[model samples]
Target: MKLISWNVNGLRAVVKKDFVKTFEELDADIFSIQETKLQEGQIDLDLSGYHQYFFYAKRKGYSGTAVFTKEEPLNVHQGLGIDEFDDEGRTLTLEFKDFYLINSYTPNSQQKLKRLDYRMRYDDALREYMQKLSVDKPVILCGDLNVAHEEIDIKNDKTNHKNPGFSDEERAKFTELLNSGFIDTFRTLHPDDVKYSWWSYRFNARKNNAGWRIDYFVLSDNGKKMLKAADIHTDIYGSDHCPIELDLDI
Candidate 1:
């Protein structure tokens, strides 16, 4: 099955930028979107062949996530069942017969590191949530995690070291997540590939190919062997971030 994840930046904005056409062209069996920045009744997507699920943030025009799948899931859940984290509408979990698909838009640490502490707490909660899910079945997690896990993940690593997304603390949390048994599908398959999935909109970064690989598709070890292919569609032009895709033989 072909599964694709992207941080659309804003659902309404992207719709005007040919989101419908691009969505059709991608032709994924399952499509997950983060940073939708919309609320109930704000916008409607006419996805004829897919079942849509959305988790909207309590705050309007802010963080949110959605999933569109051709195959019906056995169940769908919103949030991690934690009141503190659920308010942001950052997570959507879909349980199929074989595995759980988690679509998340991880909280950014903010320019001044103001949210760094909250972000760390979020990491702890998310890890526990993921581990609990893993005990039941393999989990496929994807979205704009908002952190560059290593020097290899962002261009000009030395200059970005102290930046919110590249902070050592944030990167180490991501490392802990992977060490806990999840594998970053893209890196696992193409260990040396240096392409990135997200870019800064400033200074013509995208045009210059200066970007960060913050978005990802991480899978439990049990789901790793099923990976067929993984990719970043850098050519897509709606959001500052592009889509990351995974093709699974299962």
Candidate 2:
């Protein structure tokens, strides 16, 4: 099965700019989106033959996630079940017969690390939640994790250090998560590939190929055998983030 994950930045906005065409072209078995940035009834998308699931933030025009799957899942879940994090509508989980797929939009620490404390707390809670789910079944976690995990993952690592998405704390959290039993599929599959999934809108970042590989498909360690192909679709455009894909033999 081919699964795709993208942080569309905003569903309403992207849909106006070739989102439907892009969606149809990708033709993934499961397509997961983050940062929908809308509330209920904001947009009525017509995606035939796919089951649509949307999770909205309590606040309008804010964080949200959506999932489109050709196959109907056995069950679906939203959030990590923590009041603080659940309010943001950051995660959408679908349970299949053999595994769990979680699409997430991890919180950014924000300018000057203003929200760093909250982000740390959120990461810890999310880690615990993912670990709990992994105990039940292998989990496929993907989305804009908001951290440039390694120096090779970001273009200006030296200058971006300690910034919102490149901070030491955030990187450590991601490392800990992997150590706890998740595999960074793209990096594992293409260790030397300097590809990025996200680029800044300003400073001609995309034009110059200055970007960060913040979006990812992280699989439960035991599910490594299921990973067939992983990629960062840097050529695609709509949002600042490009879609990442993970193909599974299962």
Candidate 3:
């Protein structure tokens, strides 16, 4: 089975630019996107042979997530059950026969780490939520986690260390999650390989290959056995963030 995750930045905007063609070319069994930046009825996607699920934030044109799958889910869940978090439409889960697929758009700490405390709470809640789900079934978690966990994850780690996404507090939370019986699929497979999924629009980041590996495909330790391959599809372009893929034997 093939699964793909991407932070489209803005689904509506991408739809006007190569989104349809890109989706067609991917042909994934499950395709999830984050930061859709739109409410329901804002855009129509003609994705034939796919079942679409969307979670819209109460605030229009803001944080949102969506999932498109060729196989219909046995069940669908909209959020974390926390009003503060759910109101932002940050998460969505689909229960398949063998596993639960979770797509998320983690809260950004923002400039000067203004939202750092809130983001910390979100991290803890998400970790607890995923762990609870893992108690019943394997979990495939993916999306723009919004943090570069390791120095290797960012092109200029030294310069970005104090920045929002690269702050030590955020990175530590990611480590805490990984330590709790989950595996970062791409890192587990690539080890020392250097690649990034998200790039800054400023400083010609994409052109200069200055980016951060913030997007991820994380799986429960039990589900790691099913992981065949994990990759970053940096070549595909529509948003500042590119798609990451996972191949599972299951």
Candidate 4:
């Protein structure tokens, strides 16, 4: 199964930017999107042969997530049941026969790490949530996790050490999550690859290829056994974030 994960930045905005053609060309069995930034009824996307599920934030034109699967899932869950986090509609889980697919848009710590504490709480909750779900079946978690993870994951790690996505606290939480029985699919498969998924729209970041590898496809150990290939589609454009993909033998 070929899975695609992308933080479109804004679904409506990307739609007008050849997102349809890109989606068609990728042709993934499951396509997961984060930061959709739109409320229900805002955009009508006709993706033939796919079952679409969306979790919209109460705040209009803000954080949100979505999944479009060619095969219908056995069950669908909208949020993590935590009021603090649920209100933003940051997560969506689709339960298939073999695994649970989680689409997420992790909260940014913000400039100066003002929101780092809250971001830590969010990370802890999500990690526990994934662990709980893994008790029944392994989870395939994918989205813009909002952290660069390591020096190798960011272009300017030295200068951005304390920045939102590159902060030590955020990176530590990501490590804790991985230690809790999950694998960062792309990093594991391509250890030496200097690739990135998200870039700032400022200072010609994309043009210069100065970016952060914030998007991910994380899999539980059992699910990791099925992982075949992992890729970063840096050539694709529409959002500040490019699309990341994972292939599973299942």
Candidate 5:
């Protein structure tokens, strides 16, 4: 099975920039998107062969997520069971017969670190939610996690240490998640690969290749061995972020 995840930045904007064509070319069995930045009736996307599921933020033109799958899931749930976190429409859980696929748009800590405390609380809550799901079945967690997990994840780690997405506290929380039994599928497949998925729109960063590997597809240990291939679609363009894909033998 092939699965792909991307933070399109904004679905409405990207669709006009060839998003539908790109989506078709990727040909994934399941494709998940974060940061849709749209609400109901805002845009009409025709995904002929896929079943679409969306979780929209209560706030218009803000954080949102969607999943388009060739096969319909047995069940789908929005949010992580906390009303506070759910209000942002940051998470969507799809239960298949064999595992749970979670697509998330993790909250950014903000440029000034203003949202740091809330992000920390979100980290704890997300961990608990993933763990609880793991008890029932293996989980495939994917999307823009919004944190550069380690020095290896960003080009200029030293300079970015205090930055919101690259801060030590945020990275450590990602570490904590990995230590809890989830494996970053891309890293596992390409241990030495140094490519990035998200880049800053500022200072011509994308052109210069100044980027951070913040997006991910993390699989539970039980699902790790099923991974066939993992890749980042660096050449695909539309958003500041590119797509990350995974293929599992199962």
Candidate 6:
């Protein structure tokens, strides 16, 4: 099955662009979008033959996630069983017969690390949650994790060492997750390839190809053998971040 994940930045804004067209063109069996920034009844999408599930933030025009799947899942879950995190609508989980698909939009550490403490707490909770889920079945975790995990992941890794996304704390959290069990599919597939899924709108970052691979499709060890292909679809553009795809044999 082909699964795609993207951080659209804002659903209503992208819908005005070619969001629907891009969706159709990808033709994925499962599609997940993060940072929707929409509330209930804000927008209606007509995606025939796909079941849509949305988890919206309590605040309007804020963090949110949605999943459109061709196959109906056995069950669906939102959030990490924490009210503080659930209020932001940062996670959406769909349980299939064999595995669990988790779409997440991790909390960002704002400028000057203003939200770093909150972000750290959030990451710890997410790690625990994912670990618990993996105990039952393999997990497919995908989204804009908001961290440039390695030096190769960001274009100016040296200069941006202390930046919000490239900070030591954020990177360490991602490392902890990987150490716990998840494998970053893209790096595992193409270790030496320098590809990025997200770019800044400023300083012609995307135009100059100066970007960061913050978005990812991380799979548990049990799903490693099933990972057929992992790609960063940098060509398709509507948001600052492009869509990433994962082909699984299962």
Off by over 4 Å in 4: none
**TM-score list, all predictions:** 0.98, 0.99, 0.99, 0.99, 0.98, 0.99
- Candidate lDDT scores, in order, read 0.93, 0.93, 0.95, 0.94, 0.93, 0.95
Q: Candidate 5: which pairs clash?
A: none
Total clashing pairs in model 3: 0
Runs of candidate 3 with Cα error greater than 4 angstroms are none
- For model 5, residues 53-92, the per-residue Cα lDDT tens digits are 9999999999999999999999999998898789999999
Model 1 per-residue lDDT at 123: 88
Task: Write model 4 residue lDDT over 154-222, tens digit each, in one string.
Answer: 999999988899888999999999999999999999999999998899999999999999999999997
Model 6 stretches astray by more than 4 angstroms: none
Q: Give per-residue CA lDDT, model 1, range 1-250, as digits (tens).
A: 9999999999999999999999999999999999999999999789999999999999999999999999999999999888778999998999998889999999999998999998998888888889989999899999999998877889889999879999989999999999998999999888888988888889999999899999999999877768899999999989999999999988
**Candidate 1 lowest-lDDT run of ten:** 219-228
**What C-alpha lDDT does candidate 2 achieve relative to the native structure?**
0.93
lDDT of 3: 0.95
Q: How many pairs of residues in model 4 come into backbone collision?
A: 0
Q: How many clashing residue pairs appear in each of the predictions shown? A: 0, 0, 0, 0, 0, 0
Global lDDT for candidate 1? 0.93
Provide the RMSD of all predictions against the true structure, rounded to 1 decimal: 0.8, 0.7, 0.6, 0.6, 0.8, 0.7
Error of 6 at 105 (Å): 0.3
